[model samples]
Target: MKIFKITGEFFLAVLKRTAFSFLDLMKIIVPVYTMMTILSYTPVIKFLADWLKPAMKIFGLPGESALALILGNFINLYAAIGVMPLLHLTPWQTTTIALMLLTSHSQLLETSVFFKLKTRAIFLLILRLSVAIMVGLLLALR
Candidate 1:
């Protein structure tokens, strides 16, 4: 079918792109990314996560989610996507958590990917989190 062909082509394109993109990313970002990774592993991440635990709990997620949020912020969504399977979130929980993660997902990296309206990304991301929190809190109340 046409749909199948299109899907197949899309996946092939993605594979090619991912392979090329990896090299490009490694060339440009690997050094900085490595340094950041080292910093992340050196207790700073845990310290910040601990500090933010209370605020994170308000959204029905625990501290681990905070780590995921931070990971998603600096690194990328790949890590968070891996963590999602382990969490085994329910449908409502998924929506709430997805909203929360998507709110500020990958601000450091992808923000520049937006050529125009760069500042709006942060504002929109915050708005997303707020709306997600309000909706999630209301649902939890009921």
Candidate 2:
């Protein structure tokens, strides 16, 4: 009976924490998703896409996947992932972006931590960003 009560309490706590996490993600995902959808209907998206295409071609990604890379680096990975579905990424493209972001996501947050550590944040930022790009290009070439 005691074990059963403990298990029940554990499940309840997990459920509560999970609900809050889901809500937090919804806050980021919903707004980004909505903004992307609205932009998709405008010439703004096409313009942005056209402008980015040359650079994004280096990673074999569609121009709009640039949004995901930017968001992941500056904001967080969740915000980036939110836009990917609308981008219609190929499996290879998705893998490239995922690899890139894995190396360099949440740059602002990490840079602040480096500052707090009295470390050279700019050097670290350059290193991470360059490594991400190199990894992306390597995968894109495969």
Candidate 3:
């Protein structure tokens, strides 16, 4: 009976922690997704698309793909994925974007983690961003 009580308490604690973590993630994802969706319907997206077109061309991606990159970097990969289909990306473009995000997604959250661990947050941020850009450019060459 004591063992059963301990097991039940442990499971309950795990469940509660998981739920809180999910809510924390949702707080970031939902707002970013909502803003991206709203931006898709406005001229702001077009302006950003046009502004980023030249840089995106270097990565063989459409200008609109900038939103995914921004969201993936600042928010999370899920936020990037939420915005991807709206851009109508080609397979290669999608692959390039995925690679970039995989290399350096969730900048703010990850940076905080680095800081908590007594690591150099800015150095890691720069390194990750640089590596992501280089990998993206190389993938574009293929």
Candidate 4:
């Protein structure tokens, strides 16, 4: 009887934590997805797609991918992921973006930390971006 009660309590706690986590994720993903959907109906997405196409192609990604990269670098991976489903990217493209973003995500926050350390923040920023581009290119070629 005691074991059953403990097990039930544990499961209740797990359920509560899961629900909270889901809500937190939805808070970020929902807004970004909504905004991306709205932009799709306007020329803004098209304009950005066209503007970024050439540069993005070098990494084997669509122009729409630039939004994800920007959001991932400046905001967080959740924001980038929120834009991904709308992009209809290929598996390879998804993999490449995941790798690139994982390599150099959260630049603004991390750059400030680097500055506080009295390091050459600009150099580190350039290095991370360069590495991200290189990783994207390498995955794209494969």
TM per candidate comes to 0.50, 0.93, 0.76, 0.84
Worst-scoring 10-residue span by lDDT in model 2:
40-49
Clashes of each: 0, 0, 0, 0
The prediction achieving the highest TM-score against the true structure is 2
Error (Å) of candidate 4 at residue 118 is: 7.3
Off by over 4 Å in 1: 1-52, 115-142
Query: lDDT per residue, candidate 3, 1-142, as tens digits?
Result: 8999999999999999999988877776677778878887889999999999999999999998998999899878878877887788889889999999999999999999999999899999999999999999999999
lDDT, residue 115, candidate 2: 88
| 11-112: candidate 2 lDDT, tens digit per residue | 999999999999998899999999999999999878988999999999999998999999999999889978989999889899999999999999999999
Q: Write the per-residue lDDT of candidate 4 for residues 3-65, one digit (tens) a residue.
A: 999999999999999999888878888999999999999999999999999999999999989
lDDT of each: 0.63, 0.93, 0.90, 0.93
In model 2, the clashing pairs are none
State the lDDT of candidate 1 residue by residue for 3-39, as single tens digits. Answer: 9989989999999999997776555355545554675
Among residues 3 or more apart in sequence or in different chains, the pairs in candidate 1 whose N, CA or C atoms overlap within 3 Å are none
Candidate 4: 10-residue stretch with minimal lDDT: 21-30
Q: Which stretches of candidate 3 lie over 4 Å from their true place?
A: 1-34
Off by over 4 Å in 2: none
111: Cα error in model 2, Å = 0.8
